[model samples]
Target: MDHKQIPTEIDREVRIPFQGFYNTAHDNVFDMALEQINTDDSNDTVEVISMDNVEWTAVRLGYAQKYLAEIDKTLALNARFSRIIGQKDYAIGNDILLARVDCSKLVELHDAINADPARKAAWAYYVKEALTERPGFIPYFSAEVEDWGAFGTWDDAQIDCMLAFRGIELEIDETEIAMELMEYVDEKIWSSVIDPDQVPGHVNNKTETQLST
Candidate 1:
């Protein structure tokens, strides 16, 4: 695990008591990359957007409680066990059940909310106080986990046992795993792809290893 701690201010009102995360994608973040990669019709070009091939980043549009509850009441995708990728233990967390989620329906719900000018304005009021991203709301739920800290991580098959006998819990970033995840996103997804020359040498090496395999 990397010993470096990600700097974050934990706003209890916005974060604690385990309020769920609201996922969104910014056009400022993704559309430019889409334009960059789709400039040519080569074989390596992405014809369509899918979670598997593209290194897409999801926005944490703060803990918009009312909106999140409304969205959850309409969840269409079932959460499934996700294969934990990457080598950073700090970013991935330990002894946690990572759920692979598809937020297509979630995005659809947002679209419905957005279509109504009055509802969209009302929804914006709830999240305006928090740090928010906008323009593109391509919501996604990928590899989010609830963590129990200092607890041993599957060394003696404890995680498997928990899965078999007792169901896992779903909460966001009990140990600030989300913080590390965002850091990882900034470093790996954005920096490496958007501006390769600016990424550290070590990050490029790690990216190479991940791609080659």
Candidate 2:
């Protein structure tokens, strides 16, 4: 929410579609922070990259991981309910049932794909290709390649390439968030929660309240 803190130089504006299957969807203009090098400056200017979407997703998944056991139990119950209704050929409450089926199937498919050596190799190759084709985001992927390689027996070179690609993607996402924040800052709407004028009063009140208690 602190817009001023967001670095805006490398961040660029993008148009996001609001809904699916709409010829004219609401346009959400946001900024993404990405790595860029400017040679036009008297000295070379290299900006640090960031990604808001990946950061947000990581935070959300981290929360989900914290409550994984609870999530597993809920998923289990949903799957059971789905099975029961499907066995009875009932359509009255099919939505949840269908959802459960889809979720379970997706999990099974993921596991199967992961376990397949051929599929894993294929995926790694695809990632490598993506990285090689996109050179702008090389530095970021270089940082992440080791982590990606640790997941499987993907070729070191291929994993490195993928990591390069991931870094670029991260930069793109960061630039977007940064740009959006910069706009708000430009409007003078961004400010610290505690104003300087309130600091002395806040400290005095805290001391007085502690003494009274």
Candidate 3:
């Protein structure tokens, strides 16, 4: 599965559907994840095909804009994770993983560093020139804004589960990126049978990854 970029690519003018999100690593797990999460949503109507996360996110993100920015950035090249949850379960509230620096603020910081010509050259090299590309982690430069978030919907627990279930270690902090990774939870691991006594049990039980065909 292609991961370096999406099929539609990120467009400032065009809205990308849920399927357009890039899938670099776990292609097999994605379908299973989508099925599992859809079941969790309980859209039992036969007329309705599945949980519409694209629509869901669009609405949610729109409502969440007061807290969002025109652009947000994580200083690290890798996905950033923050707002740690210190609990025995450790799965709840994980959706609040987006600990990014607002790009406006980031720009100020960048400009501040660039004020010193010597520092600017060093910083430019560090940010732009010196960085090299490698396999599975090919580096790409972009002047384009990759994604805009209707941020602050899912908790970090929900956001991190994709990596957690697949043993993928990158912490996904972008709201849009995490939204695209809705399939992180393995269906066999998360239960379809809901017990009022244990929601966590439902989330982690060994169950079928897909409905019987």
Candidate 4:
């Protein structure tokens, strides 16, 4: 009796569900850390857990606005299993992770900074440049304004508050100040999950093509 092994070909078209947040590196780190923490927890029946007092620094307003927009878009586009537990509450459970930022805290920080007159002027200049010169910048700013509608308008007072918190003074040029602020925001809003050792088979095929060409 002869036995023949069946040939099999794995379909590479199937994509695995990717999880985690886009903004803030700490978010991913916290996710990994939480897994470890939950495994170590003695109580099995605990339904809710609060991880508070995670110190966060103020990022640039533009960056935060962009990051939030990206997150909202991603959530809307992707059909994922994750649930948004609360509209304004922050909580993380076994099957769910709720992330939220304290707008009031940010507002307070902004208020303290805007108390300085010189900083307020510098912030105004920066905002003007952002509005007129950078077309791409407007959407994110508009979204932020809409989000913060409940807290009043995104006027000079609000802009001054944000600038003041960054310890920015009126002596600095608007362009330079905007650049600095954007850099801070970029850091806060950029995050990724990369498996350095893993390379897709399609990548190898592309490299082979390049070599032949």
Best by lDDT: 4
Off by over 4 Å in 1: 1-74, 81-98, 132-213
lDDT of 4 by residue, 1-213 (tens): 111211122111111111223333424444434344334357453312223311122222223334334443422222222222211223332112222323343444445535667755565565555444354343345422223343333443444334332423323233332333444333332211122123221111111011000
Q: Is candidate 1 or candidate 3 better by lDDT?
A: 1
On residues 10-73, what C-alpha lDDT tens digit does candidate 3 reach at each position? 2111111111112322222344454554463465423112332122222222222212221123
lDDT digits (tens) for residues 132-209 of candidate 1? 344654322111112222212212232232222111122232234333233333433432343344433433322221
Q: Mind giving the per-residue lDDT tens digits that candidate 2 earns over 116-193?
A: 787556545655555553555553353323254332333334423433333343333422333334333222211211
Off by over 4 Å in 2: 1-110, 133-135, 142-213
TM-score winner between candidates 2 and 3: 3
TM-score of each: 0.22, 0.20, 0.24, 0.24
Q: How close is candidate 2 to the true structure, as a TM-score?
A: 0.20
> Weakest 10 consecutive residues, lDDT, candidate 1?
7-16
Which stretches of candidate 3 lie above 4 Å from their native place?
1-20, 24-33, 39-107, 115-122, 126-213
> In candidate 2, how many Å is residue 81 off?
21
